[model samples]
Target chain A: MIEEKDRTLKEKSLEKAPTGINGLDDITYGGLPKGRTTLVYGSAGSGKTLMAMEFLVKGAQKYGEPGVFMAFEETAEDLAENFASLGFDLDGMESRDRLLVDHVHIDKSEIEETGEYDLEGLFIRLGLAIDSIGAKRVALDTLEVLFSGFQNEAILRSELRRLFRWLKDRGVTAIVTGERGEASLTRYGLEEYVADCVILLDNRMEEQISTRRLRIIKYRGSKHGTNEYPFLIEEDGISVLPITSLSLEHEVSTERISTGISRLDTMLGGQGYYRGTTVLVSGTAGTGKTSFAAQFCKAACERGERCLYFAFEESPDQITRNMKSIGIKLQPYLDSGLMQIHASRPMAYGLEMHLMGMRKILDTFNPDVIVIDPITNLISAGTEIDVKLMLTRLIDYLKLKNITAICTSLVQRESTEGINAQEISSLMDTWINLRFFESNNERNRGISVVKARGMAHSNQIREYMLTNHGIEIRDVYLGPSGGLLMGSSRDIQEAKETAEIAAQSKNAARRKRELESKLKSLDAQITALNSEFEVQKEELDKLSSEEALRSNALAKDRSEMARIRRADLH
Target chain B: MEDAAQNNNGPELVESDTTPDPEFYILRLYVAGQTKKSLTAFANLKEICEEHLGGRYRIEVVDLLENPQLARGDQILAVPTLVRRLPPPIKKIIGDLSNTERVLVGLDLLPVGEANVQK
Candidate 1:
């Protein structure tokens, strides 16, 4: 028997029950210890009950492991009502024999302990509930109520210790929710008995914004994430986002994707931003940041790639309409399901909540690229330092997922904008800074690639005009002061240069015409000389014939012979 | 979801909501098994009822080992507990009920001003 026990212990080191939460499984290495009690301690309204319920429900629904939820404080009906909004059908599961719920409520005002007793009744009820569904998981939410309800501490403590032992013997994973104590993990120090695992949930309100965070205090015989993971009690269930100051180990790609504009693509080393890289587009107001992002989205959609756009400043319709004027039609991509726009007020949620929501979307949509229009607007959601940290984690997460991200930041104050952009740029793989050039009594837009990792990007601050047709990157034209000109002055300079070129070409054509006329007169003189020579030759022939006729009269007999000879020759 | 919960929970509520009669004394003795402690608790409860109120009291002994579902109705936790069901306010007394004086006071048979707070 001793050998068999040793074999069993060696074979099964430590079994786990997967909670089936998104990132929770990754952090815990699996889940809570199997066939052991895990104490979850937290203050009131700290989402302890929700986490325990989700653990039971998700175990039943996903892993086919039936569960039991024995509420110590709230009634079964109240628990059911609370879970309804989250779309967990408790009654339906109970009917399907997948779950068993029983509320153990005790009124201290009514009950009187006359003599000594043991909690055998509770044990029997709990045992019956578990056996009814063949449960593999159990949750006793808000179990601290027993201490307050019962007057016998010795008996209650003994019975609790016995209950935990019974749960382990039954080989059922159990979660016991306890209220946070001043110095102990639980108000009643239940963690002493529950020695396998302990998780703490904290809800803190900062700057009128509340954020929920979770941390694992201890996990025996396991390696778990020790950071405070922010979780969301959102629809479908509690999703614990297990993020730490993750090690820089994300794989990078040398492949590039276009920036949509042909010239912008060329400016970015005749290609564009690298795949799985973060690009920051920082500029002042009305510098066409949103338009640039939309153009990138259009190009991605044109290549049949999906893009997720998060717009914190404008509505979806407003962005679509505004992009339409720049000759970038985003409505088609939206209709074709190639692009998705999630617009929300930055301050509507806390920074952690925003990160959680974005992670959820990234998981569900699995988009190839994401565009956050004006990430600087998140300042309203959190402090500057908080925003920077969130951005850093977000950029790292995108890189780890090999997702391309384009973040637009609004430079509100000129004085501090440089430092602000630099803080975010340190995390970005490429930085494209757009500025408004005040030239010719007007504000004109100019674009420059401040930095691009592993590429020979353009260094020129080229002028880009936002026309009704599209954005046009004009050639560099220097003003009279030898500086790069832009706007109407650049246009006037280009027109003047064109007119000068036209006059120079016209003068060359006039000179060629003059030379051609001179050549024509020389040819006419040669033709006149040839015609005079022909006329002179004809007159000499006539004079020779007259002289021969006078000589023929003197020698009539010789002329007759010459006439015959001439006739024969003719 | 709320409708389903209410419908499923309707029968349990009705089953536990027995008709209330103030004059009648209804006592339920809950025990885990047929152990010595459980038998002693039953005997003591019967003796107390016979002497205090005669035929006006009705006693129901629930063996939780056999009928575990019955424990949920009275919110039973400790074994050998006596629950006063018919009284306006329900009261529970734990232990084997050997202390007759305390049992009488707990059931209001002695007409005491208040029961022991235990704290």
Candidate 2:
């Protein structure tokens, strides 16, 4: 029993080969099963050939493993030209003795079979190519052409089995691409023969928008992601956007960064956003969502940190021209190599492609912060679920890398009830809402912090104005009516208070003049009464002197009668 | 008779000495393991050669089970296949040669009118 368990564990530990595509290796844990045949089936234009070629090119270029590509559909020269746009120099790799491209042409009309035959010619050719290049990897593009070439199904089936067994015995990993069938994974049901691993590629159209998706149907002995991943085909070639690690094991940061506007910073707990957290700035049209994001980007650039700004709705030139009106000079930052503005229409590619492009830029630019202006425009490119899944992966990847990201979403004007925020609010660490508040026959911009995780934020809605000097948040005007007033309403309220103060001052001046006149009249009355009293006193004194003189004369006559009395009086 | 012919020497002969005609029929039969189909195809081919060309025909039988490496020369894909190498245009017919009319038609031995009637 113990031995059986050990054997099972060993079987589970089957080796894998790296596909060398950007996110595919992570999904398959490594890549297709190593030294085994892996069937990659998809419809036309679904990037099957490109994926196979990239696997070979990357194998030779990055992994130091030589590869042989036997194309049954396109010639080597045609393939070289086809891949030239992606900068894959097949001829160069060929000359280096690390790659071999052999085109196997099988026209049924030209081939005449007589006696017993297997696909020995093919086996010999493949064997020579592999031996010539010492290839560790082999890719047979469009392996279904054999079905058209050979009429005997039994012979074809047995030969294919032999071919796969030969490839395995040679100890070379092989990838065989097949056309998608109506009911089976491959046109000829080749998956049944080469079933070590199977990957299905699909291109679907939804609402006139096309999206390419990839799913791993089976992996023989290893644990792999079973989700359908969105893949993109661009100038760099096909890239699969695998979901990042789902575990929340990423490190968190307590450090803060400025949001460029001082008032806005104060509203977010007196500091800016967290170093590696996601911030959602949601607002309706004309609510300065782009301007707010630009402010954050400018702040990051000014601090000598790189910032990547993805503009979906507007061209880079348009963004630059519009931002200049708000006093943000992105040109300097761009010229200094601290900021990069990548602008493209949301309809230009699928959501996963956009994510892949962003990831490529992030790796090459190594930005400290990333800004997606009006992320809601991406909703038009995919379903709500697709966009949400992409954003989740993006946010998770950014967090894992310790890179701060600011995403602005344009909410519909009619749904001012926070429905848009409700969609992505749970995914963000901070949410700031902007709205157009109309008051006193004028429209004014208002900004409020909806939520800031792990920090305290102001709950008051501040009226902000987007002027030539940038965004400025105004203090709430508490009027007599008890609600915050803004725009022309605040101006009218201020004018009314000024008029009332002026009238009260005028009444005080008139009262001062009347009191001065009354004091003057009282002083004059007192002076008149004093003068009357002085005149009466002078008359009384004269009367008293006269009486004294008469008394003296009487005393002299009496002194004659009595000489002794007179002498006593003298 | 087919088993005895399997050991016949010299499979690369241009023609049999008994018939020096330039228009002689050159035939080769491929088989594996002397199966029932191989015996029937060989017997049918011999009867057709006897009745059609007589001394002007040559037959070479190759057993692929004994020599698998020779399977690549004629692009052989199935057992019990007959190849007509001589006539300017080469032809191939698969399966056991049980239907004499198809064999004759496939090998281009029947008269033009009879082949048309068979078709």
Candidate 3:
């Protein structure tokens, strides 16, 4: 055998548990440490059991590391069958001796603990299971079931201590699932004290909206994610969230993607927006914010850059169908995995949870464009300060990652009434406003560029109509009346009622004009007076010389008269 | 869009109804022996569970001494420590099926439910 320094580079590698879940390894800062027990605690129906099992199945299938499942709740058959829904081939894995499901039967009635009984039986069973398949990972579906089965708390606690130490001693990465109990995490709560890492899972329902939350409570001896992240367990399996913690370092590509509408591209100041600029499209309800954002995402995907559309207010299927009618199809892109649509309600989660969910999806797909249609819905879950801070962090994260993040916010009015818009405007590198107006008897939509930094953009409001083809920009509707038509006729009447908005703007303009005219006249008179003063000074200088000569002659005549009188007298 | 309006109305009322009162008593029962005392304790706990704790308590019976290896958990030096777990300031009471007054006080099952007590 070669000496340690003489060995090949592969020999120096650390033993790793490849989670088999995509993007998970990156968030974990590498897979979970080898030969350590990680306690997965969660309230009922929080997907702790499912997450642990998936970790095992993925380990067995993806990496050649066979796994042993020490299930305390379900039978081997029941546990194996559940994987069918997620398309995990347990039988195939078992036949190859790559996976083993050992159900450690713990019934509450089997209580004959006499003396000095440690959890040697459990270790022997786990050891046999691991050795039979040469398994590298182990999962205990629940240690709580065992605690509930045994009445002796003291022994149970000591056994748990042994189990974790035993797992570490054997050099196997293990997941211990437990049902959350009152006050403490697990029913007995000893597992958390002994485990190398602790992860808490929670399923919370707010205002009738249910959400699953995953949090890394503690991870010993290394840096780990500390925030509670929202994860989804659908037919495909579980996906843990995007990393929300800010790190200035992220990969950015020097590329550009077009905003489908050429007019919009022009408004963004040329061929297209920079690869990573976050574009905010804010408009009132019914101004078609969803359609506006969808068009851009559609364009980006068509151009071969992947796009992930997050619809907070609509379902993915519904958005797909809706966009299809507008001639922007998502089905083909989704089929190719070039475009992904994620939909849920904002009230379904807290703001940070929402941010985490967004982060997770972004990480998994690595999309070039992430469109959160109606970020206003997300704001409803947080206070104004919270919304601003979250958005600032989110925008900063997107720009740093160089993923062009497009967000839509619903304004109460076409004009954000100036106050509420100020809160979000500072964070935006570009802002587009969609307006609804009424001209003649027809309702119309107008798109205008509010702000685009570092580039001159179109200032004129362009009327845009969503036809069967796509979003079509009409000519600059510069007619006798400026504002285009929008909303129902009844709402127009309502707008007119609220329209008591100072017709006195004309009067004010007239007064301003009169004041300006008067100020100009006064300025001209002052200029004329300055020239007159200069001309009079020149005339005065000439007159002063002539007067001096006249005075000299008069004095000489007086002297002569005096001289003549003196001579005559002598 | 119209469906969203209808769905919003239903969730509004469900949220108003399911909010829990903050001051409810919670208890987790721990037991080991299956003797007369253990049986009597379980029975007494049931009567207490239905009467004072009703809809508010969560009882988790743990048999430790029988499974001597499991006894170290909850730091059990004795047979029964009824852990009054939540709305806590968690208090633990140890007994063998006899002390009703201490159990009631330990559970905070006093002050209001006394008038309806089947003493």
lDDT of each prediction vs. the true structure? 0.84, 0.82, 0.70
DockQ of each: 0.60, 0.11, 0.01
Docking class for model 1 is medium
Prediction 1: B-chain TM-score: 0.73
Please write out the lDDT profile of model 1 over residues B1-119, one tens digit for every residue: 24533553475345445634356677878898888888888889999999978877778777878777777755788889898765646678888898877788878777554434431
Spell out the clash pairs found in candidate 2.
Answer: A115-B76, A116-B76, A117-B76, A117-B77
CAPRI-style docking class of model 2 based on DockQ: incorrect
lDDT of 3 by residue, A1-570 (tens): 566565643433444566866435655666666677788888888888888888888887777778888777888788778878677777788888988877666544323232223444455556666877899898988777777666658877877777777788888888888878787877667555554677788987654455566777776665667666656564447766544434446565546568898877776666666678877888877777888788888898888988999888899998889889999888899999999989888887677678777876877889888898878788777666556766776777688778887888878765844345667788777788887776556667888888877667888787788988788876543333544333354355555656655556767889999999999999999999989988999899889998999999988887788897765634
Q: Which whole-number lDDT from 0 to 100 does residue A235 have in model 1?
A: 61
Q: After superposition, how far is residue A118 of candidate 3 from its true place, in Å?
A: 5.9
What's chain A's TM-score in each predicted model?
Answer: 0.75, 0.77, 0.59
User: What is the per-residue lDDT of model 1 for residues A86-182, given as tens digits with 9 covering 90 to 100?
Assistant: 8889999989989888888777876767666888988888888888889999999887898988888998899889999999999999999999998
Q: How accurate is chain B of model 3, given as a TM-score from 0 to 1?
A: 0.64
Q: Each model's TM-score?
A: 0.77, 0.69, 0.51
Compose the digit string of candidate 2's lDDT tens values, residues A1-570. Answer: 999999877865677789889789989998888889999989998888999999999999888999999888998899999999788999999999888887776667544443334555467557767877799999999888888977768888988999899999998999999999998778899998887899999999888778889999999878889999877675577767764735588999999999999998899889989999999999988899899889888899889999999999888888888999999889999888889999988988777678778878988999899998878877777887667767777788899999998899888762445665677778899998898877677888888888899989999988998889888888778877787888888777778778889998988888887877777777777777677767777777888888898899888768776785545644
